[model samples]
Target chain A: MTLFPRAVNETTSRELRKTFRSPSEIFYPLIFFVLVLTMFPFSIPPVPGLFNSIASGILWTAALLAISLSLETLFKADYSSGALEVIHLSGANLVLVAIGKSLGHWIISGLPIALLAFPIGWALDLNFLTLWVLVITLMLGSATMSLTGSSISALTVGLRGGGFLLVMLSLPFFVPLLIFGSSAATNASLGIVPEAELYFLGGMFVLSLTVAPWATAHAIKIRLG
Target chain B: MSKPILEVTNISLSRAQKLVVRDLSFSVSGGEILRLSGSNGSGKTTILRALAGLILPDNGKVARLEEKLGNITTSSNSVIYIAHRHGLEENLSPLENLNFLSQVCTPPPIRDGVSVLETLGLKTSMHVPTARLSAGQKQRISLARLLMFDAPLWLLDEPFTALDTSSKKQLESMIDAHLDRKGAVVLATHQRFNCKSHVLKHSLPMIP
Candidate 1:
């Protein structure tokens, strides 16, 4: 196997193990995702026509917030316990490490939210076809969000009150993904094919995968320096 | 005399835009221990970080000679660095941590994880979460990396801070054995390292 994939796999497995060691950490983002989505129904009217119109926007926004909240933890623990120094000295590809961590973050936080989106959309009166589109779009968009947020998390890992900075830095980047994802879901609800929005979401996902790891690696190096 | 395996020439480093290490230079060959002695905040740890390739010196060169390949491994895979904080996860056992370390390490160490924990007197704490371990115990767990990596050079920062008397003796012996095996060490510490073996020791005194 090539070194990049091998290193990425090793880092991913370690990250997964560390994440699961605390059950609360593993479930916290998903819980936050559900809670934020639940609150939308109360704040907005539960009338079928009104709820369906706003549901896609509400779901994307909630996923964005939950994923961002979870990212506060991406590098903080490693930085605090000095594990990151060991990793730096290990001579492994830091880019691979960054990509692997983002992968793990997506698996734990993004994947579950995407899976749960179908049922949540059903409760919001979205039809089966639209619900399916919601799941796919969420999966793509959340993965992109995780990748983008990973870079910001890496940059702010050790700073005092970095959590606030994380939101400030990443929230603007999220605007594009939100626009594309919610548009896809809304078009699906309107019985349109939604292909263009889905294509845009996939393009963003691909762009994030290509760029986020390198950006995150540079961020980590700057923080360590 | 054996060729110097590691050399640092006239390196200067800074933190927070203020210079900490100014015009520093040192080298060590196989079977030698370079002890960086100084009071707190004297840039001992920063210098070690520079040596371990964690950060680059603002001015100067750090070169590590590769004995087998004749290629320099300047900032990668040739040095093992133990920083002030133990890197082991608080929720994971020593065994798990070592296993994870082995996975990430390039050209992994030959020592078995079980034997290394046992040798470091971590036999009882092998399966216990590191957070439950005492400070000295955690330090010992960090020191266990000496047995877990194949790197020829070690950069240790205040490795004896939390160790008790016996653990300190044990660590010294471990360092002695490492030197005996032709591995070099650069240790930054305020405590005296007791080694009965006839090994070359160079003390680099730092100005506070």
Candidate 2:
């Protein structure tokens, strides 16, 4: 008990460093997010009002998808090397470990990209307040996405077809978050107000908090068996 | 001098709706060495997992020393089970591996990790990552865990697979020392060990 949270924190930080040290992996997704968002302004009609109207939606979905890109790496190495077994056997609360692992993953793939999206948002002619709001919203939203995606990834770590299976299984989950997040962004663009979407997003985040770690832990046990 | 360290009664396990072990029962008193001998898929690994409480048995009982053993009661960190897979981080050296395990687990008093490696016959290459070690070296490192875990019960699956003759004899001596201290060992091995007096052997049939 004296050492558990420290251990969890240490493990999370270690995972963060490991992921960030590899520059190729870090920048590729961020660049992909930018490039995908850039494609949007050209594809749709060239009115700033129209672009801004759905721009928040596009950016939010892009942020959500970007977080999903690196989910496989969350537990694949640990699970493969028998580290998970040692953790499971150590009498540590597996839920805390699950949460730590999920958080570690968010640090690696979600946080930085969301932070950097601010300048990118400004370049898209997004309202300054909306851009700041979008940045904060994606930071919170994508971190949640990364955490949930990691749990899903851990659940399918060694299973055959785990890659496609993760997407197929987790997309339904992402829909509600996507709808609410983008709608909030969309509402911001049209000045439709933000409080209701914020409340809904908060509710979803809380719901995922209650459910995802437990689901991930159960999946790990099944995969371990 | 004391009660048995472990007790199992009428334990059965089924994986994926197929019975792997049925009505299997065994007990190891303090300082006794029990070897589970069976052909592949005879529930040797299954039994070890059940004893460690890593797997729940549908119809059985297991009691560990100072532990109220059951499906959920297994959160205790006292017993250690090393699987056929060895449960090691192959990227780390023997010392590094032990250090990592010690951080996460309650370790036996071996002082330093390398001293435990010395006991396992790890030589100059002892400091190299386990990926550089031969299969036998890795096996020794895996077994070296016994030197670091003060736990009385050892649930080892095929601890002798890649061991050399001298290493195997060292293992025998270690078992002797553990028994002298009243520590019990539950092992699944195909190798023929020469501890005739202290051993109670159970043969597992492939079909049952």
Instruction: Show the colliding residue pairs in model 1.
Output: none
Task: Provide the lowest-lDDT 10-residue window in model 1 chain B.
Answer: B67-76
- Residues B79-184, candidate 1: write the lDDT tens digits: 8888899987787888988887676666666786899999988898899978899999999988877777777898888999989999999989888888888988
Quality class of the docking in candidate 2, CAPRI style: acceptable
A160-201, model 1: which lDDT tens digit per residue? 889999998899999998998898888888899799988899
Model 1 segments beyond 4 Å from truth? A1-4, A41-48, B66-76, B197-208
TM-score of chain A of each: 0.95, 0.88
Q: State how far residue B67 of model 1 sits from its true place (Å).
A: 10
Would you list the clashing residue pairs of candidate 2?
B108-B148
Cα deviation in Å at residue B45, candidate 2? 1.2
What global local distance difference test value does model 1 have?
0.83
What is candidate 2's lDDT per residue for A1-225, written digit by digit as tens? 345466466467556555554557767668767777778878988875787667778888777676676677777877776677755764555666677788887776677777876787787787766776787677767767876786789878977887778777777888888887777776776666688878877877777777888888777776765
- Model 2 reproduces a share of the real contacts of 0.24
Per-residue lDDT of model 2, residues B1-208, tens digit only: 5767888888888877878888887788877989998888888888888888777788878888877565543332467677776556555567766665555443324456778887677857666867778888887877766777677787878888888899888888888887888888898988887663469889887764
Q: What shift in Å separates residue A80 of candidate 2 from its native position after superposition?
A: 2.9
